[model samples]
Every structure is written in C-alpha cells, then in structure tokens.
Target chain A: MPYISTKTNIVITKEKETTIKEKLGKAIELIPGKSEHWLMLSFEDNASMYFQGKSDSGIAFVEVKLFGSASSSAYDKLTAAITDILKEELELAPDKVYVKYEEVSNWGYNGNNF
Target chain B: MPYISTKTNIVITKEKETTIKEKLGKAIELIPGKSEHWLMLSFEDNASMYFQGKSDSGIAFVEVKLFGSASSSAYDKLTAAITDILKEELELAPDKVYVKYEEVSNWGYNGNNF
Candidate 1:
C-alpha cells in the first residue's frame, strides 16, 4: 500500500483537488511496486504552515509512505513528479516543497496487518 | 521539526481533538531530537478508510516524520504512548491503529531547506 499526503498553505478547489489526485495517481507509477488502485492521497489546503518564520508564503509538505523499499533514484523521480504536478496545478514552488518518504515494515488494512 | 498526522474513520469532537493533540505533543517528547515546540499535528476524522475489505470499521493511520533519526525503542515508546492516548481520547483500538515513521534528511522551512 502507498499513501501520499500533501499539506499546503494555498487553498485548493474541488476540481483542482481531483486533478491533483489524478496526477499523483499517475506520477506514483514511477516507483516500482506501487499502483493507483491501492493508492491513497490526502490534500489539505490553507494549512497553518510557516516558512522562514512566515505563513503568508505558499508551501507544500508531501509525505509518501509505502510498504516496501524504493531506491533513492525512485524517490528523486517521485519528488520531481510531485513538485512539478503541484507547481503546475497549484503554483507551488519546487523549492518550497518538502517530500518525505517512509518504507514501512508493517501496514494494516482490513483489520489485519499487511 | 516533527509532524504527526492521523487519519481515522471515527468522528472526533473539537474538545477531544484538542485533548488528543495535547497528549501527542507530550508523548512525542519521549523521542529525543523532538519537542512540542516545533511539533505539528493534524487530525482527520471520518476519513475514508478501509480495513479487511471493509470501510465501516474504525481504523487509524498515523504518520510521523522527523528531521533526524530515532531508535526503534523510541518508536516503540512512541507507538505505545500514541495508541494509549488515541484509545483514551477517541476510543480507538490499538490493533486497528497503524503508525509509520520516517527519518528525513532534508526538510525545508521559511523558503530554505533545513
């Protein structure tokens, strides 16, 4: 299972959120052993986030968690894809985006650990 | 900085949410290199979550990310504290809760990478 969550200071419309979900669904394909079918994406707009001690600026915090391991190269691609997608869709700067990855040893679903 | 984000299917009231956040802020102190001062917590109640091919059940997805490394023992303590707090505050079971941790080398804030 793979879950991608993004929290941004910029507000997003419903249509844009859908577009972003779709784009992230496709972008995640770059990483092996991940698919949109089992993908979960969460977007939070107008978050209480600060940059350089200020909150007026737009920033994005992206968290990516997967069941298995991925190469740094894969993370690089994923970050680029997500940054590009957010920039194009929400005008968020790549420099202002932070993407963190976690390779979880255990994940639970359907009442059982996976 | 340390960020804790939780997604659960159960509905949480504002008072309980505040309690949970405050509890988590204290619980995170168990881990070295983390403090409540720079802690960020987000809670999403009534989330669309599925377990064992079902969505009606109560389940929690907790994601924790920090700037530096933390020991597995530290994680174990964090898990127990979080589970206990969540169970007490939201009445969520420990078995249905999933906690994932990430040690990020790169984090950005205030228009600069940290």
Candidate 2:
C-alpha cells in the first residue's frame, strides 16, 4: 500500500479537518497499494510567505514517503494532483503549494518485507 | 556529496534572500559532496493552516531529495537545525516553519554512479 501523508501549514478551523482528511484520503486512494498503510498529516498556520519576482504562486516544502509499487509517471501525476488539490482546496497560488514525492522500495519498508 | 535542496514557502525579501541563502548555504555546506549540486528552492505565501488540536508547533509538507553520503544521524540533526534556524530567523512560532529532508543514493542519481 502507499503510505501517504498530506501535511500542510495553513490557518484552518477544527471543522475543516474532515474536509482536509477527505481530500487527502481521496488522493491517497488513487495510488496503487493493497494494505492498510499509515497516513500521517498535520497543518500549520501562516508558515508561508511571499517573495517578489517568482514564477510560482504558492511554494511549499513537501516530503512524502510511500512504499508498495513505484512508477515515475504515477509519481509525477500524483505530484500534480496533490499540488492542484491543495491549491484548489486551500485556494493557494500555484507557487505556494509545492509537493515533493518520495517512494520507498520493499526493502526500504523497514523490514516489513519478509 | 549530499545533493540538498531547501524549498520554502515563506515571504522572502531580496534582502532576506541573501540571509535565507546564507542560512541554506551553511546547511548545504555541512553535508559532504565534491562537485556542486543542484539547490532548487522557492517560496510561497500562506499554504499552511492550523487544525486547532495538533502537537506540532509548525506543521509543514516538507519534501527533500538529497544524494551523497548517507547518515541518518546527520539527517536528524540537519532536520532539527534547519527547523530551528527557520524558526529563529523568521521569528516564527515553532509550528510555522517546516523542513523536509531527502537523501538520494548514488544509484538513485539517474546513473550518476560511475
């Protein structure tokens, strides 16, 4: 399964947890995996700041860890999808929501691959 | 050499770029590498939102990709240092700045292994 984590640092209400979780859940479900994987996520508020003369609308420091099957294309698509989702859901500019994807192999699964 | 990248989504003044780059420059220099590696980073404004009930001071979606020497202790320290620096430099609350760290192996370097 794809162990996914949708971490964000933004101002959110307690009521918004469900919405955020739901969106992340859907995003994780899109990846190829067949098991109950751990999904860790948290949010931060007002962590992002703007810089002048930049191409990105919203830029973020993203680090994701997943293990199951791996594909660069899927990785790329997921990056775009997750970034897009965050942008739309959070109403963030493009350069604001940066997504960095990581894929661990079966061996990299912390001895879980016996 | 550790190919490191420190991506941020915070408002950075041109004056701040020099300071930001200085901090990041120290960080990258700490890691071991021979040739110059790619340090790609950008900033965003407000991609983080609070969830009310979270332990993390600053929750961030941090994704880092580095390839050079391998050491989890250094990684851990690097994480803590970078996070701490961001917190102190920006004078942001503990939960505002998030740092994601990634390390790629020689093999993961797209056949960079000679």
Candidate 3:
C-alpha cells in the first residue's frame, strides 16, 4: 500500500481536490508495485503550517508510506512527479514542497497487519 | 517537530476535533524534548480506508513523524497514549487503531530544513 498524505497552506476547492487525487494516483503508479487500487491519499488545505516561521507562505508537506523499500532513484522520480503535480495543479512552487518517505515494516489492513 | 495525522472512518464533530487536538498535544508532551509548540496535528474522519479487504470497519490510521529516533519503548508509549486518546475522544476501539512511527532525519519548517 502507498499512502500519500499532503498538508498545504493553500486553499483547495472541490475541483482541485478531484484533480489532485487523479494526479496523485498517476504519480504513485510510476513506482513499480504501486497502483491506484492500493493507494490512499488525503489532502489538508489551509493548514496551520509554518515554514521558516511564516504560516502564510505557500508550503506543502507530503508523507509517502509504502509497504517495502524503494531505491533512492525511484524515490527521486516519485518526488519530482509529485512536486510537478502540486506545482501544476495548485500553483505551488517546486521548492516549497517537502516530500518524506517511509518504508514500513508492518502495515495494518482489514483489522490485520500486512 | 512532531506531526500526528489521524485518518479514521468515523465521522467527526467540531467538539470532538477540539478535544482530540488538546489530548494529542498532551500526548506529544509525554515524550521528552517534545512539546505542544512543535506539535502539528490533523484529523481526517470519514476517510476512504480499507483494512484486510473491507472498508466499512471502524478503523483508524495514525502516522506519527518525529525529527529523531526514539526507543521502541518510547514508541510503544506513544502508540498506547494516542490509542487511548482516540478511544476516549471518538469511542473507537483500541485494537482498531493502527499507529505508525517514522524517525525522520530531515524535516522542513518555516522555509528551512531542520
């Protein structure tokens, strides 16, 4: 499973949210063994987030959690794709986006650990 | 910084959200060198989450990311405390909650990396 959780200072509309999910689904698919079916995503807009002590700046924090390991190069690709998606869809600067990854040992699904 | 992002299938009210933030702030302070000032929390309810093949169950996904490493026992303490908070605030079963921890090396804040 791959879950992409994004928190941003920008405000999101219903249309933007739909487009974001679609774009994120495509971005996740760039990694082998990841697909939209197992992808879970949540976007938080107008979040109380501060970057360099300023909360009004346009910033995005993205956490990507996957079931297993990925190469740094693979992560780099995913990061670029996500950054592009946000920049294109939300008018956010690529430099303002932060992407974090986690290779999880055990992920719970269906009341059981996977 | 400590960011606790909670995604659950339960519907949340405004009052419950306030109580959750307060309780989570306390939970963060339970760990040494952590406090409410660096705590950033988000609660996502009625989310699209699936466990073990079913999406209708009462399940919660909690992702906790901290700037540095912590003892497994420390993580255990956090998992228990957060579970308890969700249980009391949202009447969710402890077993239904899944807590994930990540020790991040590079965290960005206020337009700078920490």
- Candidate 2 residues A40-104, lDDT tens each? 66555444332232323443444456654556655555566666666666665554444554556
Cα deviation at B9, candidate 2, in Å, is 22
Clashes of 2: 39
Task: Report the candidate with higher TM-score, 1 versus 2.
Answer: 1
- List the candidate 3 regions with Cα displacement exceeding 4 Å: B1-5, B13-60, B64-114
User: Which numbered prediction scores highest in DockQ against the true structure?
Assistant: 3
The C-alpha TM-scores of every prediction are 0.60, 0.47, 0.61
Q: What TM-score would you give candidate 3 relative to the actual structure?
A: 0.61
DockQ, candidate 1, comes to: 0.12
Sorted into a CAPRI-style docking class, model 3 comes out as: incorrect
What lDDT score goes with residue B90 in model 3? Answer: 83
Put down candidate 1 lDDT per residue, A1-114, tens digits, no spaces.
787878888898877877887888888888997777667666678889998888877899998889888999999999999999999999988889999997886454433345
The candidate with the higher TM-score, 2 or 3, is 3
Instruction: Order candidates by lDDT, high to low.
Output: 1, 3, 2
- What's the lDDT for all of these models? 0.80, 0.49, 0.79
Q: Candidate 1: which pairs clash? A: A51-B110, A52-B110, A110-B51, A110-B52
